[model samples]
Target chain A: MKLQAAIDRVSLDRANEIAKGLDGIVDIIELGTSLVKDYGFETLKREFVGLNESTLLFDGKTIDEGEYEFEKGFEANADILTVMAGSSIDTLSKTYEVTEKLNKQMFIDLLEVEDDKIKQIANFKNAIYGLHHSKDNKNAFDAVSSVAAFHKQFPDISNIAVAGGIDVDQAKKLSEQGIANIVIVGGKISGADDPVAAAKQFMEVIK
Target chain B: MKLQAAIDRVSLDRANEIAKGLDGIVDIIELGTSLVKDYGFETLKREFVGLNESTLLFDGKTIDEGEYEFEKGFEANADILTVMAGSSIDTLSKTYEVTEKLNKQMFIDLLEVEDDKIKQIANFKNAIYGLHHSKDNKNAFDAVSSVAAFHKQFPDISNIAVAGGIDVDQAKKLSEQGIANIVIVGGKISGADDPVAAAKQFMEVIK
Candidate 1:
């Protein structure tokens, strides 16, 4: 399982510094929605000039105007962009097509989506289906159990990513479970005193 | 009924120019989600100057991290900010609390959400429940009928706003129906050859 470090709610300069520090150390560096909504994509595209080795993912959380958001996100040099699973099927299909045509990736954020909705959108072969827990929920996230249940429900969706307050131990267990392709650690890794050291710890455990 | 002129898919300068143009004419001026994502709330707070009249609505389309997004959005001088109804109940409640505490309005974008979900979230009595059609969904929207049906379904929820390809005739009908509190028009008003003239025409019709 690959480790994806999410950098969120920070200044662009700080985010760039973190990305450069974590370059090639983690599989992916996610510019979380807060960054995108706080600083804007144009800044990310123009000013955020690091990540020589790590892939950059912009969590646009696009719920509508999928084509425009995807195109803009790709133009911002995002290797992957996220669209909400709660978005209309038309929006999902449009974003998937845009991602495929651009040869980039799309991460479908499965936040607050019903099973029926997930089943309908599970056909995007190249897209990574993210099993996300709401940040405001204040609930415990059992990543391993959530992933197992999601796998059982949508066996065809091979590319799975799980997020929501994930820690190093949970990352290790997820790696052992051998189901999720990417284990997204946000505050646990990025919010630590030494993000690089924390990322390294997570990488070691997952490895 | 009120007219909300939405400025979207344009440069920040253009958005400002349009917002300036539509000020005082329309009941509300929406800096659409594209602007919030493209330029950001910080930029909007700093650069988007000159809205001397008309309520400013930032279409944040906030799905999660509700309190943070809402606080930032309101601090950016937005009189109103939007949250996705499809968001977890926890997120919705948190955002509602933030809005209530801050004395700002929250517009719940009911895009692509099932009626059951609507029924659950309808109790946010102060929120303006928006019946929105996804721009990506290539489907026709009957504003008058949709508002009528939604009113019938959620009669207790007084505030209603409708969007998606609304025209002057439909605006007139919605005003006549006396259901929706706001009639949100996008390209029809903002994308017109003469935006002020177009807005005036709609205002005349609704009156």
Candidate 2:
């Protein structure tokens, strides 16, 4: 399993510093939606200028205008971009087409998508299916159990990722379960006092 | 019926000029999601410092982290912020609570939300329910018919807003239909050779 570190709700300068510190240490680096919305993609794109090692993912969470958002995301040098699973099938199909045409990747965020909706959108075989929990919800999420259930329900979804408040221990267990292609850790790693040390700990556990 | 002129996919300078020109002419001035993504909310917020007349509606299209996004959106002086109807009941409820506390407005974008989902989310009495057609979708949307069908299905939903490819004739017809409380026009009004004149024409028809 690979580790995806998400940097969120911080200034562009701080985000850049963190990304620089974490370069080559993590598998993928995510510029969270807050950064994209707070600083704008034009500025964020400039911040992402020279990362030699890790792939950059922009969590655009595009719910509509998939083509424009995808094209802009790619132009910003995003190796992967995200779209809401709750978006129209037409929107999902369009983003997937753009991703394929650009020879890049798309992560479909399953934040509030129902099974019926999921059934309709699961045909994007090459896209990474993200089982995500909303950060605003006060309810607790059992990441391991959620992943297991998701795998059981959609066995054909090969490239799967799980996000929302994933910690080092939970990530270790998820790695042992051998289900998700990538385990995304946000505050647990990025919000720590020493994010680099925290990231190292997570990397050790996931490996 | 109110006219909402959405400014999208343009440079910040152009958007600001357009907003300045259309300020009091339109009932609501939407800073489209593309602007928010391309320019960042901080910069966009700064640009919106001195608008005197129309309510500024930022198309945040927030899907997760409802409280944070809502707080940031409102802090930017937006009178109205949008949340995706496809978001979780928890997320939607959280955003509604924030909007209520702040005494601001919330617009729920029902781009691809299902009837079952709408049934669950329809109780936010103060929220303006938006019937939006995805821009990425190639299928044509009959705005008047869609609004009528939506009104028929959810009679309790009083404040309805319809968007997508609305022209002068369609806006006039929708006003004549007397179903929607607001009609949103994007390219037809904002993309016109003379946007201010186009906006005035829409306002005349609606009024």
Candidate 3:
């Protein structure tokens, strides 16, 4: 399993600072939706730089107008962009086509979607299927069990990611489970007093 | 019925020009999701200005982190902001609370959501329930019938809006239907050769 450190709910400068500190430490560094919506692609493109080792993912959470948003996001130098699985099939197809054509990546955020919806959208082989828990729900998300169940349900979906209130222990357990390709940790790492040290703890456990 | 002229997929300067021309003619001026994602809220707040008449609606389409997104969207001078009906009840509650406390408006976009979900979220009586057809779905949308059916299904949802390929004829029919409080027209108005003239056509028919 790989560790993805998610940076969110902070100023652009601060996010950049955190990103730089965790550059080569985490496998993927996510610029959360707050940054995308607050500052936007153009601003993010110009400002968010200097990452050489880790892949950068922008949580675009695009629901419609997939072609335009994906094009802009890719142009803004995003290695991977996200689209909501709840979007129409046409939308999913469009974003996937854009990602494939550009040779980048797409992360399908499965937040608020059912198994039926996931089955319909699961055909995107290259896209990472993310089992996300809503931030506002304040519910406990069992990363290990959730991954095992998701893997069992869809044996074909090999590139899996799980997020929502993930911690170091859960990360370690998920790595032991060996099903999820990426374990995304937000707030715990980004909101910590020392994001670099916090990310290092997660990285050590996941490894 | 009220007319909302949506500005989308155009340069910020062009969008501003069209917005200025349609200011007093339309009841609401929608800075579409395209504008929000492309230019972002900070730039939109700084650049999109000088509108004295129409209510400014930003299509935030916020699925999570409800309070933060809603607070930033409202701070960006949005008199009205949108939240997706597909969001969790917790998210719905947070956005609604913020909107109510701020004495502003919330437009709940019912894109790709089922009747069961609508029933759960329809309690935000002050929020506008927008019956939106996905832009990616090529199927023809009969706005008049959609509004009628939605009204029949959810009678408690009174403050209603409709969007998706609305023309002057549909606008006239929806006004006669007497259910939808607002009709959102995108390409027919903002994408027309003369946006002001197109808006006038819609206003004349609705009246």
Candidate 4:
């Protein structure tokens, strides 16, 4: 299992600083939707200039106009971009095609998506299916149980990822479960007083 | 009925110019999701300084973190902010509460949302329920038919808006049908060679 650290709701300078500090520490570094929506692609594209390692994922959460958003996201130098599973299959297909064409990656954010919807959209084999919990919802998400249930439901979905308030212990549990390809940790890792140390802890546990 | 001209997938300077051009011509000027994602809220907040007459609607498409996105969108000087109807009831409620508290407006974009979902989310009495067709989809969307069907299904939803490939004739028909509170037209006006003339024609027909 790989550990993905998400950086969110912070200034660009702060985000860049954190990204640089966490470079090569985590498998993937996510630029959260807040940063993208707060700073725009132009600023982010320019700010996130060089990184020798760690794939950059821009949590675009594109719900519509998939082609335009995905193209722009890739042009902004994101190695991976995300789209909502709630989007139409056409939108999903378009984003997936764009990602494939660019030889990049796409993460399908399965937040608020029903079973029927997920089944319909599960055909994107190469796409990483992210079982996400909404940030607005106050409900507690048992990451391990959720992943187990999702795996049972969609056994064909090979690349599985789980996100939303995941901590080091949950990461370790998920890693132990050996089902999820990637475990995404947001506030637990990025929001810590020492993000690098926190990332190292998560990395060690996941490994 | 009101006419909303959506500005999308363009540079900020061009968007501002178009917004300035279509200031009082259209009832509402929509800064589409592309703009919000491309230029972002901070740039838009600073750039979209003042409007002469038309209300500004930002397509924030708040799927999660409803409060944060809604508050940020409203603070960006938008008269109306959009939230996805596909979002959870909690998210919808949170955004609606913010809208109510601010005495502003919320437009719920119902794209790819099932009838059951619509039934669940239809209780936001003051919110403008937008019946939107995905641009990514190649399927045909008869705006008038869609509006009529939605009205028939959810008679309780008083404030309704319809979008997707709307033209002057279709706008006239929608105005004649007298169900939708607003008719959203995108490329027909903004993508036209003579945007002002096109907008005037739409306004005249709707009137």
Query: DockQ values for all predictions?
Result: 0.89, 0.83, 0.81, 0.85
- Cα-lDDT of candidate 4: 0.90
Q: What is the lDDT of residue A22 in candidate 3?
A: 88
Q: What number of clashing residue pairs does each candidate have, in the order they appear?
A: 0, 1, 0, 0
Q: Candidate 1's error at A178, in angstroms?
A: 0.7
- Candidate 1 chain B: minimum summed lDDT over ten consecutive residues — where? B44-53
Model 4: fnat (fraction of native contacts): 0.84
DockQ of 1: 0.89
Interface RMSD of each: 0.6, 1.0, 0.9, 0.8
For candidate 3, write residues B1-207 as lDDT tens digits: 899999998988999999999999899999999889887888888998658988999997999889999999999999999999888889999999999999999999999998889988888889999999988889999998888889899998999999999999889999987889999999999999999999999999995
Arrange candidates, best lDDT first. 1, 3, 4, 2
Q: Candidate 4 lDDT, tens digit per residue, B34-61?
A: 9899878888888865588999999989
- The CA lDDT at A46 in model 1 is 83
- Cα lDDT for residue A106, model 3? 98
| Per-candidate local distance difference test | 0.92, 0.90, 0.92, 0.90
The parts of candidate 3 lying over 4 Å away from their true place are none
Q: After superposition, how far is residue A138 of candidate 2 from its true place, in Å?
A: 2.4
Clashing pairs in 3: none
The TM-score of the first chain in every model comes to 0.98, 0.97, 0.98, 0.98
Best candidate per DockQ, number? 1
CA error at residue A34 for candidate 2, angstroms? 0.9
Which regions of candidate 2 deviate over 4 angstroms? none
